[model samples]
Target: MRRVIMLRALVWSVLLFVVSFGCAQERDPIVRIQANALSKAFFVGDLKDPTDDPEFYLRATVVDVASGAGSDGLFTNSDAQPTVRVRFEITEDMLLARLTYERID
Candidate 1:
């Protein structure tokens, strides 16, 4: 009886482990950004579709961009939105952070 229960418990543990692992893997997104879209948004602040208010023209993940350096997404406006075009990169301290629309695959 002891052996049977122990064996059953081991099997159940393995099953549970596998199930949990599979779930974790699926929870993360696996996606590729369009290069044209990425460059346009990151460099030119041009989103092909000039969306509605807040203007979510870019489809991307909130991520780091390096311009001979590294950068993180930042917010702007009274609404506190992440990424806004700020004067054509005119100011030394200003940066454009466009809202990212993530595409899940």
Candidate 2:
């Protein structure tokens, strides 16, 4: 009888652990490739845990300098320098805006 009780408790403990771990996980990648094509900073506001997806817009900050006036072709064709890295989180209502940095020569 004691052995049976111990085995049942162990099984319950393992199941509980797995369920809690999955619930604590976060969401998917917030930014899409189409959004990254824009030559400005994209701000996603108020990202919480990993189980949320927010809908937001983008605002252009700095355009390409040498391409042309009002021309966003200033970035290079190669996947080398002059790129932006966006750090963000997913939330229920708004996206969590982390930080965006431009790497250009």
User: Whose lDDT is greatest here?
Assistant: 2
Scored by TM-score, the top model is: 1
Candidate 2: C-alpha lDDT: 0.53
Off by over 4 Å in 1: 26-87, 90-93, 96-105
Stretches of candidate 2 off by over 4 Å are 27-105
TM-score of candidate 1 to 2 decimals? 0.30
Model 1: colliding residue pairs: 83-97
Score candidate 1 by lDDT: 0.50
lDDT of 2 by residue, 1-103 (tens): 9999999999999999999998996878787558436332233332333334333443445443545455345433432333344455544565455435454
User: Across residues 19-103, which tens digit of lDDT does each residue of candidate 1 receive?
Assistant: 9988884456866766554333444454443432233333334455446653333422323543433222213556455434553
